[model samples]
Target chain A: MISYMLCLVLFSVGLYCILRKRNVIKIIIGIGIMEYAANLFFVLLGYRTHGRSPIYAIDQEIKSMVDPLTQSVVLTGIVLGLSVTLLLVAIAIRIYERYGTFDITKITKLKG
Target chain B: MEISFIAIPLASAFVVAMIANLDERIQDCIACLAALATLTLSLFAITVLSGAGSSGAIVYKVGGWVPPFGVSIVIDGLAAFMLVTVNLIALAALFYSTGYMKKYTDKWKFYALFLLLLAGINGVLVSGDVFNLYIFMEIAAIAAYALVAFGTTAEELEASFKYAVMGTVASCFIFLGIAFLYGYSSTLNMADMASVLASKGPSGALLLASVLFLMGFGLKAALAPFHAWLAYAHSSAPAPVSAMLSGVVIKVLGMYAIARIFFNVFGITPVISFMILTLAVLSMIVGSMLAFVQSDIKRMLAYSTVSQIGYVALGLGVGTPLAIFGALFHLFNHSLFKSLLFLNSGSIERVAGTRDMGKIAGILDKAPLTAYTGLVGALSICGVPPLGGFWSKFIIILACIQAGRPILALTAVVVSILTLAYYFKSYTPVLFGNVTTSKQIKAKSLFTMNAPMVALTVLVALAAFILIPVVGNVFMDGAVASLVRGISYTDVVFEALK
Candidate 1:
């Protein structure tokens, strides 16, 4: 229970960073943090107290096992997160190249 | 057979990327052929599903495993309808890109990403598993983020960064929602999950998941409050990308997901319906109000997209048979006109070298093809009589009244008028006026670009004819019937799986 609460707290903190940060790199980091937190929450959901690994052995009977589906799904999520983060970082580098600043406040060429 | 929708595009994207350097012309041909093939397959799927005595859906279990244990691809009435709309626009956009992308340095990369995006969309439309949907959504979203920044200009990079960040956040929320659903139901297959959810009833976790999905997909769709990133992202990308993004991406990823989950999986309750109604009304009013003040043509169209989407959402919110029919019809019509409008904007930008309506004039006199097509699109979007947009909007309003929501009906009428007012205000100066600037108009429009625009314009002009009873009962009714069946959708999928 406490672990789930911690995950929520971490997610909230990441959301705060994304919303409050003015630096482009910081915002990207914030997105990464939020993604990790979500992935962590998903992994935690599959946990079973005292449960063994989900892998099967031909010789033994297994009474309890942790859910491996969420683990695999979370792995995919992490990979997607990595790609998104890399893209964001690449765009940040280009933005710096073009605008000469990482501060989002300074990049105001587009507006309504 | 259904896997062909995804396989063709995935194969083409891979081939285009690997062999792009070897032969440029070959890559273009491959891309067009892939799009055409997908379009043909989608048409075939529609006919097969809609045939009399057919079961109304096709379920292909991956690896031949049964559902609730393995991922499945299910193509039903709704999926087929959306598939046709998506592939049709994709074909047009791919053809247009062949010519339009010549100005850009790397045409192959654009075709590659475009095909990947098409694959992602098709996968989303057909996937019968919740996690599979999210994975495909990510594929499409990532490709879109890269395409938005393809220009590498400061504004493009900035917009792409902002779009990528927000899109990632939305995806995380969707992922979390899927996690909650999986935890609650212990199943990933949508039909099985729906059955589990129905038996157990709605719990706090289920409600929380619903909220998370609302936030996530709502942002993707750019619905009202979550719509800030749309104008920038849509306007900054090259026009073909913009057309795809505006025409098909949001509808497929956002609205289709919303309708599929809320109606099929969760089974829309009165409270959920009310929430959808409120969001729809807010988006309708706010999106149009914001659009009325924009000077940039593409930005205006972006906001207009937000407003038009509100109408579709309203149809879903009403949740009546007629309303869903109107919604699905509008969804189809919007894709036609919106893609046409974006393509027109692209051609105008190519010729005039600017997107600002205030700086350019006399396009009708100079480029009659682009001007007329754009006018058809603009008028169709404004819900003018004898056009596609009019019949859909009229049906939605009528549905609102029939559903005992006269006030909402009145609001729809008012929003329709506001839609016309703003489109006329912004498009008139560019389409017909004195040649204000000395920007020389290119005498000839590229045939490739002009061809797609003309094709879409013809479709737009004839779109209203779909309302003819024979066609409406055949094409639109099937989609409407599926959604109106609501939670019974699980039974349909299970039956098809058998």
Candidate 2:
């Protein structure tokens, strides 16, 4: 339960970084941190102390097996995370080329 | 057979990419054919749905394994309606692009990405698995980002970047919500998850998941609070692409997904319904009021899309049979007229060489066809009498009244008047008044551009003609039945799987 609350805190911190940070790269990193917190919380949902893998062998009893679905879900989620990160990096590079800066504060020609 | 709706477009996108080295003409032709094929298949999906009466759901298991173990595509009424709306606009947009996209350099890449986006939308609509929907949504999102940046101008690139950042954040929330749902249900198949949710009842965790999804999909839909990105993104894209984005992409990725998840998967409670209604009213009022201040035609249309979607949301929020019908019908009507209006704006932009409504005066004398279609589209969208928008708005208002929400109904009426005022403010300047600049560039896209606009105009007009008891059943009532049935979805899925 403490860990769940910690995950929420991590998410809030990431949000703060995004809201307060002026650098585009920092904002991207904040997004990444938030995603990691969500992924960690998802994995924690299926965790139990001393729980083994949720797999069955012909010779062994399958009692107290840990939920494995979150593992697969998180794996896919990590791939999604990678793509978003790459996109953000690409956007950051483009911003640098176009405006000659990484500061989002200066990237303000698109008003109204 | 149902899977073919997605497979056809997916295969065509790859084919377009592989043969992109061929001539640009061939690439454009292939894109148009692919879009036309998708439209035909979507119509077929609608036919299949109408014929397959009361039969739970049609599951097309990819590798022939039963769901809960294998990924499947669920073809039902909601899927059919969404497929029709997306593919119809896709067809028209591709046709319009045949001429307009000549301004851009790499024609093949544009077509390939467009088809890929179509595939993503179709996949999102039909997939039974929650994770698969997210993947398909990302595919569409990435393709849209690329398309928005296709012009490579400073403004286009900046808008695309902003959109990408915000869209990625929305996807993160969606993924997290899906993870929570999976954790709660232990299954990724939406129907299977619904069964588990039905058994367990709504928990704090599930409610949290719902809220996350609402926030995520609301961003995607450009609902009131999360709509800042839309005005920029839609305005930055080329006109036809903007049309497709405003007309279909947001609905499929945002509104359709929200409706499917909340109504079918989790079931709508009074609290959730009330929350949706509040968002709807906020979006309608704010989006319209903001639109009234925009001088750029496309930007104004983008805000109007936000406002019209508010009507769909309001209808869905009512959670009654008539209300759902009105919402879905308004959704259908909005897609048709809005896409047509955007295409008209694109045509005007093509001729006038600018998107500012003030500069493009008295175009009616020079471009009669586009002017006619623009007027029809504008009036229809603003809920003028004997047009498509009126019936749906009338039904939505009636549903609000029936549901004992007179204030919501009154708000709908005020927004309708506001919608009319803004649209006319755009229309009268562009279509009537004095012939401003006589730039004699031969406009050569009558078949590819005007034909689709005219066809959609007819469909919008037909909506009014058939709003009576006879034709209303298949068009509106069927959609309402699909939504109002709600979590009876689990039973339908189990029965269909058997």
Top model number, TM-score = 1
Could you give the fnat of all candidates in order?
A: 0.85, 0.34
Off by over 4 Å in 2: B52-56, B437-446, B465-471
Tally clashing residue pairs in candidate 1.
0
Residue-by-residue lDDT tens digits, candidate 2, B96-119 = 888788888878788888888999
What tens-digit string does per-residue lDDT give for candidate 1 at B178-222? Answer: 989998999999999989999999799999999999999999998
Highest lDDT against the true fold, candidate: 1
Candidate 2 lDDT for residue B461: 81
Q: How does residue B323 of candidate 2 score in lDDT?
A: 86
> What 10-residue stretch in candidate 1 chain B is worst by lDDT?
B436-445
Q: What lDDT does the true structure give each of the candidates?
A: 0.92, 0.85
Worst 10 residues of 2 chain B by lDDT: B436-445
